[model samples]
Target: MKRNPRKVRWTKAFRKAAGKEMTIDSTIDFEKRRNVPVRYDRDLVQTTIKAMKRVGEIKARRERAFFKNRMAVSRETQRAHRRKIIEGVKAGVKLHEPMSVESPVSSKVQEKIKVTAKRHTALLPGEGRSMGMDID
Candidate 1:
């Protein structure tokens, strides 16, 4: 079967994804959600370009290397390696694992706090409980 790749215009701008990640999003009720932004770090990519040039190409070890040099690029030119590996795919190099609105939680921490009203209860095992917890 003949194959034709989808063409997309490239620019130095953040393009939002047409759809949301099904894994990261799951709707139970009839509520609706907006699409998550597909962010790309144009600046970071520029930084990586600078870093790569500065480091130069690293010498691939001589010992029986895993999966035989797929790109067969010289240790003198690094971009040559990436060019051979990634062909035609635009916007190369993934920028981090993406962002999320949720905060990271520790597994050992409790989710909710239980408040009990006591007139003479001890607070810190000996500090004597306060009258009430002012959440203000």
Candidate 2:
């Protein structure tokens, strides 16, 4: 392939200014001939462009590092969520309790009036207790 002289000159100029390579796309208009900057010049053709391997390696390394950080954050978030659920269970927060329109003040007062679990209870200790395992 013989590339046009004008296309070759413009491609060289674009690469020199941008510090990157661009291929002359003769199919398109001359003003829009230069494509996006590539890691290696596509004009000279003998074998594969040398810089392509380095560019690919750099991209792969960056992608791996990004996913690694993302996974770490995801794991941390999951652990924190699990810890919160456990703590809520320990505090007697019925995690799976269905929502209903009940008076907040009345419920609080009723909780105080009710006999403590230690003092008196109809059911046997730990007989029907649950961890409220609804994890929606």
| Candidate 1 steric clashes | 1
Tell me the lDDT of model 2 at 82. Answer: 100
> Which regions of candidate 1 deviate over 4 angstroms?
1-73, 76-78, 86-97, 101-109, 112-136
> lDDT tens string, model 2, 58-83?
65676576568767988999999999
Best by TM-score: 2
Off by over 4 Å in 2: 1-33, 36-43, 46-48, 93-136
Task: For candidate 1, write residues 98-136 as lDDT tens digits.
Answer: 687665886688688788876774544424655556445
lDDT of 1: 0.45
